[model samples]
Target chain A: MIIEGKQRIWADYQKEIADDHYFYVRSCIRQNFFPASEVTFWKIIRDYVHKDIFENEHHSSCSGIGYHSDVVPFTTTQAVVARQFALMTENGYKNLTSSCITSFGVYSEVLETWKNFPEELERTRDILYKATKREFEVPENVAHTSDLIFKYRNQINDMAKYRLVNVKTGEPLNGVEHIGCHYAKMFPSKGVGGAEHPYVLAGMIESWGGRVVDYPERRACCGFGFRQYFVQANRGYSVACTKRKFESMEPYKPDFILTNCPGCPYFLDRWQYVIAEMEGKTYGENGYGIPVLTYEELAGLVLGIDPWDLGLQMHQVSVEPLLDKMGISYDPVKKYLGVDNKNIGQPTCPSVLKV
Target chain B: MGKLYDMLKKDVRYQEALKACINCGTCSAICPAASFYCYDPLEIMEIVQSQNETQLEELLKSDKIWYCGECLSCSTRCPRGNTPGLLIMALRKLSQDTGLFVESEKGRQQLALKRAIGDNIVRTGYCIYIDTMKPERHPESGPVYEWIYNNRDEVMKRMGANYKGDGPGPMRNIPQETLDEIKKIFDLSGGTELFENIEKYSEQKAKEMGLQFDETTDCEYFNEIFTKTTKKHTL
Candidate 1:
C-alpha cells in the first residue's frame, strides 16, 4: 500500500505534442496479440484525429525484449534503434510514435544512455551509416501512441458519442487504469504523470467519463517480464504479479481494467482466465471476470464502433458483460466472423459465469 | 588483472543503474519475480557488492539471474536509486558472454529464444508472426484463433485488416526493401554474431549433455529446451 517516489502534480506532466507527421513503429507482439487495437488506433488517428501517421515497411522490432533477455548485446540494440531513427529521417518524420510501451522505453533508454555517453551514440551512428549507407537525424519529438492519445484525450471526448457510464443503469462505469511500468518507470519525467502518479490510462478513462478506481497496486507491473513469460517455469512470477494486482483491486469492485501497454491488457485478461482455472475464482461485480481493454479499444467503444469489430471475441476473459452494460449490439452467434466472413466458429460453450 | 566485478563496474548500465547500495531490501520486497521465485534482488546486489569472484562466478552459472523478468520495478523503488533489474541485465550479459548461461535450465533456453524471437526478426520484421502462432505451439491463443486462422481472408476483411495481401495496412506484407535493410543491419550490428554465439555455446552444452546439437533451429536438443518446464525456483 506504500506509494513510492516523489509524486508530481498533473501540471508537471504535460507532454509536448508531436508534429502532425509521425513515423509509427508498431510492436511485433501487439500486432500478433491484438491487431484490432492497432487497427483502431490508426483509424482514429487518420479518420478522427486527422493526423499524418506513417508506417513504412522498413520499421522493425526495437529489439527491447531481445536486448533485455541478453540475447542481443547493448551495442546491437543501440545500433538497431539508431536504424529506426534513420528510417524516420529518411521518411521526413519529426515525431516518433512507438506502438509498444517496451519499444518506447527502449527508445527512451537509448536516448538517455546516449545523453550520458555520447561515445556510444557516435558508435551507433557510425555503425548505422556503414550498415545502410544512410545518414540520419533524430526525431524532434518521441512519444508513445498512448501518449499521443492521452495528450489529446479532451479532443477525443469532444467527439465521443457514448460516455463511460452504463446506459441502462445511468451509473458511471467504475474503471481501474493500469499504466505500463516501462511507460513511466524507465524515465519518470518522460511519462504522462511521472512514475509515482502516472495518468496516461487514467487520463483516457476520465476523459471518456469513467470513474477511475485508485487501488493499492494501481502501478503494479502486468508481469509480462520478457523472459519471465517466455520461460514457462518463470510464468508463476508473471501470474503472481497479476494476482497481486487483482487481489489488491478486488476491494474496489471495478467494472473493467484498461491499459496502454500491449503486454498489460493481454496478461491482465489472460491471467484472470488462468486464475479462474487454477482456483475457481472471479472478482468483478458481475462475478465472472473483469473485462480488460486497451485504451484504443475503449476509444473505439466511445466512438460507437461495434463491440465485435474491436476483436472482443479474441479475448480470453469475456467482455460480454461490459458490452451488455454499454448496450452495444451485434448478433452473438455471428460475432465469431473471421477474415472475409468465412464464419469462424466460436468456442463450443460459454463460461457458467457469463452474464 | 581485473575481476569480473571490476569489469561489470566498467559497464555503463552497471555504472548508471547502480548509484549506491544501502541494502534497504526495498528492491527485493517489491520485486514481483522475487515474490514467486527463490530470487532476491537485494541479495544479488549484496553478493555483487561483496566482489567475491567465487560468488559472482557461481551466480553466472546459476539459474537465479534468469528468474528476473526485468520489469525494472526495483529501479523505481530503490531508495539509493540502484536498479537491481539493470544489475540483473549486466549479470545476464556477463553470463551469456562467458558461455556460463548454458549451465542453467533457463539459460539453456537462450537458444530456443534466439530461434523463436531473434530469428523471427530476420525472417519477418516481427518478433512474432501471426502465421507462426499455431494452435499446437500456443493453445493459449484459444480456439477462437484456430477458426479465425482457417478463414483468415474472410475474417480480416470483416475486421478491416489487410491480412497479408499488400499495400499500406496493418498485417500486410512488409516491403521487400525493408526486409533487406533489416537483414543488412542485423549483419552489421553484431546481431548475427550474437546469434552465432548462442548457437555455438548451446551446441557445446548440448554436446556435454550428450544431446544432438544441429546448427539448424530444429532438432531434438532445441525442441526439448524450448518445451521443457522447470519448478526448481517455484515457491
Candidate 2:
C-alpha cells in the first residue's frame, strides 16, 4: 500500500522497525536528473525516521540502465550487482532497498535467480571474491522503498497528527496513486498484485483517508524507457500512454497524483502539459492536468510539515494548487528553491562533502 | 581499418563516458520517439562497438533513422554520462559520408527534400512564400503542400522567422561567404548532384509505374523526380 506523505510513515516506521541497517541502492537517473529527491528521501529516513541505513564507498552502480541499451553485457551487469551485494554483506546489511525502479528490479532479479542458478551465481561470486577477498550471499528479501512503506503501514496511519483541508472549494481531497513498474513488475509470484492494478501505492493512499482513482492507462510505462527518448522521435506513443492515464483519471478530478518513484512524477507531471499543448487541449477541462507529487511530499503536508521542508517547490510544475488543496499557505519568495535552499544538500555518497 | 579503429579509439571518451550506465532501460523506456520507431540506443552502441558494416547499413536504410525528435531526456537521465542521442547523430553523419544507405527510397526522398528546402532557403532565406489571400494564384498540388498552406503561420512561428514580400529581397540578406561555404560543403559531400538526380528520377519513375504524375506542379514534379531516381539506383 502507498501512503501519501512523509511524517506519518517516517514516524510510524521508526517506532516499529528495529532493523534500520538498510542497504541503499543508487539510481542512475535519480543521481543525474533528480538528485534532490534522492538526498531528501535518505535524509528523512536517516534523521527523522531514525533508520540505521548504510551506504559504503565500495558499492558501484547496478548497471541495469545500460543493459536495455545493450551497451553493457549481461555478465557485466551481473558483476556490478554482485560487487554491491558483496559490499553490503561485509557491512552486515541484509536487506537492500533502492529508490530507483530499475535498480530495484535488476538487483532483485539477480538475487532471486542466484539461488536457482548456482553456476551463474558461482561465476559472479568467484570474480568478486577473488578481486576483493569478500564472500557474499544474496539476501532473503530485496525491496524497493514502497515495500518498506507497505510493511509499516499501520504505524504510519497511527502517527498521522494532522489532516489536510482542501482549500480549493472547501472540500476534502482525492488523489490518484501511481505504482511504479520496477516495483510492481519485478516479481510477479511474490504477489504484490499484477503490475497493472497494483494495490501497494493505492492501498497506502486509502489508508490515509484519501480516495484512489484508477485511470485507463494506469499500467502504462512513464515513457522513460531511458535512451529511447533521446535517439528517436517516438515520444508520441509514450506521451499518448501518459495522456490516456490522465484522461482516465480526469473523471475523478483528483487534487493531485502521488507516486513513489521520482521518474514517474517527472514524466507524468511534465509530459501532461506537453501532450496537452500538442493536442491543443487545456489541462483542467479535457485533461485532469493535476500536479504530480511524491508520496513523501503528500504525506508531509497532511502531517502539517512545511511545504518548503518537504521540497515541494523542486517540482517542474507549480504545486500551488496542491498546497491550496491541502489548506497550506506558502510564501513564494520565502520558499524559493535555490542553491542556498536549506532543503537542498549533497547526496550521502562520500564524494559529496558537506560545506 | 587500423585508421578507423584508431579514430574510434582516440574518441574513446564516448565509450568511457558511457561506462557508468546501470542498464536500467530507463533511457529506452522513456524515449518518446523510440516508442513507434525501431531505433534502439543500446543496439546502436552494440553495433558501433562491433563495427559491423552490414548492421550499420541496415540501420541507415530504415525510416527509423530519421524519426528522432532531438529531445535530450535520455542524456539527462542516463546513469552513465553517454548521450545516445548524440551517438545517433554521429552515425547519421557517418551514413551520409560513406553513402552506405543513400540508395534507399526514403533516403533519396529525404535528399531531394533537403536540396529543395536548402535551395529555397538559400535563394530567398525563406520557404515558398505566397500570399494566403491569393489562393487562386497559389494552388497546392498535394496534401503535404495543402497542409503547409493551411499552417503557414504556425510553421513560420515554429521556425521563428518572418517572410517579407519584397522582390529579390531576403536572399540578399544572407552573407555571400556563408552561401559559398554551404555550396562548398554540398559539393564536397556530392549532395548537389545526388539531389538533382533524385528530383529527375522521381518524375520518370512516377510515370513508368503508372502513378499519378502532376509534372505541371512543382511539388509533384519534385516528388516524382526523387522517386524515379531512387528506383533507378539500387546501390
Candidate 3:
C-alpha cells in the first residue's frame, strides 16, 4: 500500500467538525448495547470538557435501522429525521452529533438526499407538519460523537492517568481500529480520514499513545448487518463476515480492538465469544478473547475513570485481562454490583471464552 | 422496457443507484454478502439494466434482492458510481409492494423485519427497545447478556442511564404523545401501508404453504421465516 497516496486522500477528506455547542441524539441500540458508552460521551463532553451539548427528552430515533431494514419507507425515514431537526431547531442548537454511526450515516444520507432532491425535502416538510406539526431547519454541521472525542483527544490525554501502553513493558499497545462502514462508505467526505482509512478512531489511539494495527481486513465490516443479525436464520452470513475480519486480524495479535460505532464494539466483542463457541477457537492470547472497546470507554479509561463506570464488566470478552496488562487498578468484588451496592449476579460461564 | 422496469424507474433509489452498468464486477468483488452467499451485485445490476420483465420479475421474487446486508460497500467501489445496494433496496421495496417478496424464502423474511424493527419503531419510538432485548430470543448477545438483561434496571442506573425513567438521557421513556406522533408519521408516510401489505401478502403465502397465520409473532409462518435457512445461501 502506498502511504503517501493514503495520506493525500486522508488530507482531502478532512471534515470541519464543530468546535462547541451541539444538539445530541441517542442511538436506538447503543444505549441497550453499551449503555455507559453514551453516558461516558456525555460526561466527557459536559463534565470533563464543559461543552454545551443539549439533548431533548422528546426527540426519538431517526428511523435509520427500520429504513435500512427495508421495512420503513424512505419517505417515512426522512420525515422522522426532519422531526429531529425540528427538535434541534426548536431547542436553538445548530450543530448535531449522534452516538450511533448508523444514525450518523442516516443524517449524512438524508442531508445529501435533500440537497439532491428538493421536492423530496418539501414532501418531508409537509409530512412532518401533517403528522407532528413540526417545522425544521437543517443543522449547520453534522458530526459523529467520535469526531468530538477525537477533537479533544489531546485535552483528555493531558488529564489521563494511564496511556495506551503496557506499564511493565513500556511499549505502546497495538489497537486494531475498526471503522463502521456507514460512517464514510456512503459518503467519504463525511468522515475525518475518509472511508478507506478513517482517522476518527486512529487519531484518538495515536494521541493516547497506541499503535494502530493496519490489518488486512482493517476496512472490513464488523457484521452488524441490521437484518443479517436481526433475523435468526441469516446470522450465518453475519457471523461469517465477522469471522473473516477476526481471522485477518488474528495474525497481528493486537492487544485490543477500538471502535467508534455502537454496533461495531458490541459485535466485535460478542462475536469473538460466538466464534469461539462455534469453532472452539479463541483470538486472544491463552484462550482469552481480544477485548473490544468503544472510543468513549477508551477515553474514559485513560482519563482515570473506573472501568466499571465505563460499563467494561458488561462485555462478553472481559476487559480485566487488558486492565491487568495496562496495570489499571480495580476491585474485582465490585464488578457486578449495582448502584445500590447489591450483587447483580454473574452469568453462567461459557465453555469456550474464558470470561 | 417492460412494466416492471417502468415501476422500478419511478423509485428515487432506482434513479440514484442506477447511473450505468459497465459490468466490471467491482461491486460483487467488494461486497461482504457476496463473499459468503451466492449473491452478486454486478449480476443483479445487469439484470436491472437489461429491463427484461421476465428476468426482473424473477430477480424480485427470488432471494437475490434479500441477500444484501445494506452495508453499501458496493456503493463505495462502483466505478460507474451505480449503487447496487440502493438498487437492491428499491427492488426489495418493489417486491414487497407487489406481493412478490413472499415468493422466495429470504424475501419472506421481510415480514420478520416488519414485525421486529418496524413495530418496535411505532410502539417504542426506537428501532430496538431495551425492554424487548431478551436473552432467550437474542442468544448471540452472548452469555454475559443474561446478567445484564436481568440486572438491566440497576446496571443502567449505575451507568448513569435514565433506564425507563422519564425525561432526557439514554434509554429514557419516550412520551406517549411522541410515540403517537411517530405512529401518525408512519401512517401518513406509507410505512403503515407497507407494513400492512407485508402481513397481508405473508398471510396469503402462509395459507398457500399450509402454515398457520396469525396477528402475533408466535404463529407458524413467522417461525418458518424466522428460523428456516437453506444450504443454498452459503457458498
Candidate 4:
C-alpha cells in the first residue's frame, strides 16, 4: 500500500510529463565544461528511456544568464524565450525540456509573467513576429530534463547494466545528490519532491543502488550565480558558498558528487580545485578530491559507456578511483588518444597546487 | 528620467519578488551571500519597501547589490513567500538601466561580463565558446585544459562531440541563418540597445578612471576588472 501511494504521488508529481517526445534546448555551460555529459544525456533519453528527442542547432540560448547578469531586461528575455517557443512550435513539438536549470526557471517565470500580464505575451509576439514572422503556442508541458529523468528512474533501474556498488566489495557506493537550487527552490511545487526534499537527484541515486548520503549543506546553492562567479570582486561569495557545502559534505566521504544542473556540476567541481589553491584545503581521503559527475554521466558510467568517451579525463578530479571500485576497466593511454586512435603522450603534468 | 518609486511600482519583477516583509529576517538568514559578504537581502528589501528614492538609487550604484548569487535559495525558505533573490534581480536591472551600475567596483565588471558573455551570445549563439575559454582566464581549468586547448579537436572528437561540425548536435556549427535570426531578435527585443548603453556608460567610467577603454575585450580596464582578486576574502 505504501509502494502504491508512493507511485501515486510520483504520478501526480509528473502528471504533465512529456510523452516520450520533446523539443530539447541545450545548456551553454553543459556543453562547455562537460560536453560529453550532454551527449550522454541524449544517449540516455535514446537508449534507456527510448524517447524521441529533437535537438535543433537553431534553438538559441534562453538568455537567462544575460537577464540575470542585469545586462538584459525582462522584455528581451521574454522575447528570447518566445523565439525559442516559436521554434518549437515550428518544429511541432509541444513538450519542451530545457537542459539548464536557469533556463527552466526563466521559462517558468516567463510563463507566470505571461499569465499575469497577457500584454507581455503580446509584446513578445510582436517582437518575434517582427524578427521571424513567428507565432508560437506555449508548450503544454514545460519540463526540465532532470524532471523527466526523475519520472523514469524506476524504468531506468530495471534496464541498468550495473548498480552503484563497489563491484570488488559488493558494498553500495556512498553518494551525495546535489540538486540544483533552481530545479525546485524558486517554485518548490515544480520539482519532484519540492525544495526541502527534492527527489530529482536523490531518486536517481537510490534507483542506481547508491546510498544517498545526506549532509547539512545538501540544500545550499552551488554558488555559480552568473554575476557572483563571473566578477572577480564578487567571487568570494561564490567560493565561500561552495566551500561551505564541501566542508559540510566532506565528513560523509562520498565517492562522488552527482548534480542535475549544468553550472552546479561545473562550479562544484571547479571550486573544489579553487578552494585547494586558495586555502591549501582539500577534501576526501588521502588528498584526492571528490569526483563530481552529472546524473547523466553517472547513468552513462553505470550503463558501461567508456569513461574517456564520457569526457571523464576532462574532469579535474579523476574518476579512475570510482571506476576501479566499480571494476570498470579501460586502457589508461586512451585517455590521451586522438581520433586517429593513437596516444598523444601524457597531458602536461597537471598543474595542481602543491600545498 | 522618472521617479524611481513609480518605476519600481511598474516593474512586474518588483511586484512579484516583493510581499508583506513582516521584518522576520529570514531572507538574510538563508542568503548564501550574507554568509560570506556583508550582504543582507532583508535589509535591501526593507530599504526598497520603505521606498526611499535616494537609498534605492544608492543601491543601484552600490557594490552590495551585485552580491546576490541568484541561487533563489532565500525564496524557498521565506515564510512570507517573498523572493529576495528576485528582488535583487529587479534591483540589478534598475541599476544597469539607469546607468548607475558604473558607480561600483562590482558593477564596473559589467563591461567585462558584457564582452565575455553578451557578445559571445551574439557571436556563437552560446554564452561561451571553447576557443575563448582561455588558460589565462580560467586558471581553475588548469594544465589539462591547456593541453586540451592545444589538442581540442582531437579530444573533443574522441569524446563524440561534434565540435564545429556541419549538422546539429553538441558543438555543431550553428548556421548563419540561425545567428542572423538571433541578431534580429536582439535588435528587435532591446538587447542590442542595452548592450550599447552598457558600453556607453562603461566608456564614460573608464575615461573618469583614466583607464584605457576600447571596443575590444582586452582594454586595460577590462583586463584589470577580469583578473584582479580581492585580498579581503583570501583568508
Indicate the docking level reached by candidate 2. Answer: incorrect
What are the lDDT figures for the candidates, one per model?
A: 0.80, 0.51, 0.90, 0.82
lDDT of 1 at A61: 82
**Model 2 lDDT tens row, A1-355:** 5576655544432312235677876554443334445555565566555677766643434555543332333444566677667767878888777766767766755665565566668777665555445677676556676666655555566666444445455555677777666664434433244443466677667776676766665655565544333222224445665776777777777777878775678677656556544564535432335777776666666555667666554444457766666667678764443334433222121111110
DockQ of 1: 0.61
Q: Write the per-residue lDDT of candidate 3 for residues A260-327, one digit (tens) a residue.
A: 88888888888888888888999999899999999999999899899999999889998887898888
DockQ for candidate 2, C-alpha atoms: 0.03
lDDT of 3 by residue, B57-175 (tens): 99989988888898999888888888898999999999999999999999899999999889999898889986777787778888788888887888889888898889998899999
State which candidate has the highest TM-score: 3
Itemize residue pairs with steric clashes in candidate 1. A338-B155, A339-B153, A339-B154, A339-B155, A339-B156, A340-B153, A340-B154, A340-B155, A341-B154
Once superposed on the true structure, which residue ranges of model 2 sit more than 4 Å away at CA? A1-20, A47-49, A130-133, A161-172, A194-197, A285-288, A337-355, B1-235
Q: Model 4, range A219-247, lDDT digits (tens) per residue?
A: 99888888877766566667778888999
lDDT of 2 by residue, B119-188 (tens): 4333422222233212333121112223334544432222222223221111113344433433432343
Two-chain DockQ for each candidate model: 0.61, 0.03, 0.86, 0.69
Residue-wise C-alpha lDDT for candidate 1, range B1-235, written one tens digit per residue: 2478877776678878777899989998988887788888888999888889899999989988888888888878888778888888888888877788999888888887787778877777777676765656654444455666666666666667766756666677777777777777778777888788888899988888888878565687887787776546677
TM-score for candidate 1, residues paired by index: 0.94
**Quality class of the docking in candidate 3, CAPRI style:** high
Model 4 lDDT on a 0 to 1 scale: 0.82
Report the alpha-carbon TM-score of model 4 versus the true structure. Answer: 0.95
